[model samples]
Target: MILSGMATPTRRSVLALGLLGCALPGQAEEPIRILTEEYPPFNYTDKGKITGLGTEVVQAVLKEINLDAPFQSLPWARAYETAQSTENVLLYSLNRSKEREKLFKWVGQITPTDFYLFSLKSRNLHINSLEDAKSQNLQIGTVNQDIGEQFLASQGFAVGRNLQSSAKYELNYEKLKLGRVDLWVMNELGAYYMSRQAGDDPAVVLQKALRIPELSGGGNHMAFGLKTSDAVVERFRKGLETIKKNGVYDALQRKWL
Candidate 1:
């Protein structure tokens, strides 16, 4: 009874139509762009590939959802801006702060770190607390836009006056070595790593400096752009939970720490 201009549907056509109807709706059409800065033991470029604890954890989470996203290492400020402006963007090893609480959709905590004020042993600097350091009126070296810098700024340390901000952590280390800055503010682990990278024995450097604990911002986290869909964020959150339950998260931490 089909018209000459109309094609007749067969059993095969009916089955094909049924299969198309079963396809999942609202599937993500694009891969997420993960961003990070060169913070060693967390996320950094090694042998032209992004590899680190945070990177590994993120990869595992994405794998659970059958998604693979490549990490792009950019300057901290640039990465922060890009994640703020772009949808489907992810950033990790990000410190959770009151000022940054509502800026992004947080996924889960990654790792814990302690910030400290390090001064050369030669200076014999004695600082038991933040108030003691402030009394000294020392020039503190910090990476631009880093959490340490933010914390100091919140404490009334002004840039170009008592705070010397550098775009690279290595530059801050250099400033510390040159005595351009009296105290270098950095993460405990990061200070050791940067000391090693600067061709100094990390243990020796640690022995030579005083590590006065300054800021302990609970922990770092993986976060997505605020505009990203809740569904996508949930997928990542579930994946993170799955990995943690399966002991993969602890394994990654052991490997790095």
Candidate 2:
């Protein structure tokens, strides 16, 4: 409050006092939080360290931006929630779906992935469409809040009925092999990558039962939360563009993909 005899400060006076530059006494910018999940080749934990295709691409982008934010691997659901609601938070390898287009400020694409519903060749699941899979009373495995899970939910699939959600993809992978889950919805590259990680020959064991066109193509992206400034978002966007233009992106693809 102003004093009894004090006059209201004019715009020029406020600027002169440097009040415009610092809106509040201690309102400093929040620390940057870069988060990802264990989706593999894109981003995953490896032998007590975090590194992958998407992780490395993001690092290159950060280098171009001259920003020093480390990546943290979290559960998919938690990472999604935190990236949506928190300020100065960046998440990568995110599917730039129409349902999520306006949720955050997009940076740029990482790498392309073909999404599919995979099942064991032993089961010989004859799934050709979403309806076909649902009609058969097949249990579909998914990671909670993952893009595949969310897409199915939007199409009226609900939990405990036909959709089975897990915190990790490994659980779903194991379940699918054990006949616990009739189908596993995942990207083709990730499905094979994960199968190899589990010491199985994906080509021999897993079959791509159905292709999801909407969820495929156009690759994934690095995105900032809504609370972030457009200026910061643009800076990071330019960084991604820089890496893609300078041959760094191609190098990463060859290294990890």
Candidate 3:
């Protein structure tokens, strides 16, 4: 019989399982390979370790399901391709798009990310609506091949040149501060974290949080992508349900952000 209302495991469980996997035999352990681009406070390489909110959240989910796994920082496009083609592979913090609805299974609503438009605080920029951005010579900076890039391109916004798709978002934040770009576009949580890494300088501020009415609830619900395996997706879904009920996710969010 299936267990009902199993509470999601915590970080301690992840360490325990990883250790157990090493100690056992004939019981092959599968690692949950995650693809991620540098988006600070979410995923970043520091001192030879990949640690961030995104990493932590995925880890917590794995622990809940008693899975032994690890994540790697990869090029965003490569990561997405890998997740689509490989088994047990997953991508995190991905914007749920209709184009990709059938590509993979999902886990975690993760966090509420509000996309916004930002500029230097000193600049006298007034954005009452998204159309206001059209009149000004605004060049929005976003990662290469990201949903933001696709959104801007589709709108014929002629945003600035695409920036490098690094796992770190601070690079783009710095670029915005340097006047290399007139405006920066990204999810709210990402912008907040990037700004913290950028320091409490008075020069940066979000002018307007433009929402897309067409997207799911005017925002994207991020999820972990898995190969289209019935067993694996079911397992992950159950694990995620438990985590949501157990407050495991809430604690991690408080610790990381």
Candidate 4:
């Protein structure tokens, strides 16, 4: 069937599981290795267990397809490098961009994320526009956050200082307290997740968003990444469509968020 001229997937019509690496003779029923970064509310560790909206959703998706996979969390930069450099590995909640479209075999959109600029509420700074904060010394905290990093670098904004993977959020929060940074950039959902994880209040709140051509054109799409291969990409595309059609996608969102 057609959904706005796009093919839709249902649980009943999986269309020959044999071709989906399911019953392939040489393939083993082992776990697919996935590289991930801690992006709070999306992917993070709690009590030594990896858990987050994106993490859980990806897990559920793999489970439904009987695809065994284990997620390993690392620095965002390192995780992305590993996905591209390693074999049979996937990265999740990755931003979609033209530069990266051809980089990996893509799959499952975990969610639509909103990019925002955050600052201390007491900073008394009103960022009605991206250019408004140009004159100020803004230190945006992002842990190899793809879009955020690219956007700032492209615009020639001062990156201030690089933050550690696990400490980006909390470091930014503390930076504001010490008058070390002016503003921090983060995803709306991500900041919230990190706030709870750090057990600290976000003195800096989302002030505005950085408007870039890529993000505006495509919006924000968070998906999984795998090695570039037609079969792997097709398999994941089909699985994602099935989940969306079966209400599993929406249900998971409501359950988690």
Local distance difference test, per candidate? Answer: 0.81, 0.86, 0.65, 0.64
Off by over 4 Å in 1: 1-27, 207-214
Best by the TM-score measure: 2
lDDT of 3 by residue, 1-257 (tens): 13333434555688888777672432224555667777766777889888787677777777877777666887777777777878777777677766667766766466555666677776656677656666665666777666776666666665343332333356667877788776677776677766766576333464443555433343333344554466667777777678778998788778875
Q: Which candidate number maximizes lDDT?
A: 2
RMSD to the true structure for each prediction, in A, is: 4.7, 4.9, 10.9, 11.8
Q: Give the TM-score of candidate 2.
A: 0.88
Q: For residue 94, what is the lDDT in candidate 4?
A: 82
Question: How many clashing residue pairs, candidate 3?
Answer: 8
lDDT of 4 by residue, 84-106 (tens): 87666778878777677877776
TM-score of 1: 0.84
The parts of candidate 3 lying over 4 Å away from their true place are 1-31, 135-137, 158-168, 202-206, 209-227
lDDT of 1 by residue, 165-249 (tens): 9887878878887989988887777778778877897666553344434456577899987888888889899999999999999
lDDT of 1 at 30: 55
Give the distance in Å from residue 87's predicted Cα in candidate 3 to where it truly belongs: 2.7
> What total of clashing residue pairs does each candidate reach?
0, 0, 8, 1
lDDT agreement of model 3 with the native: 0.65
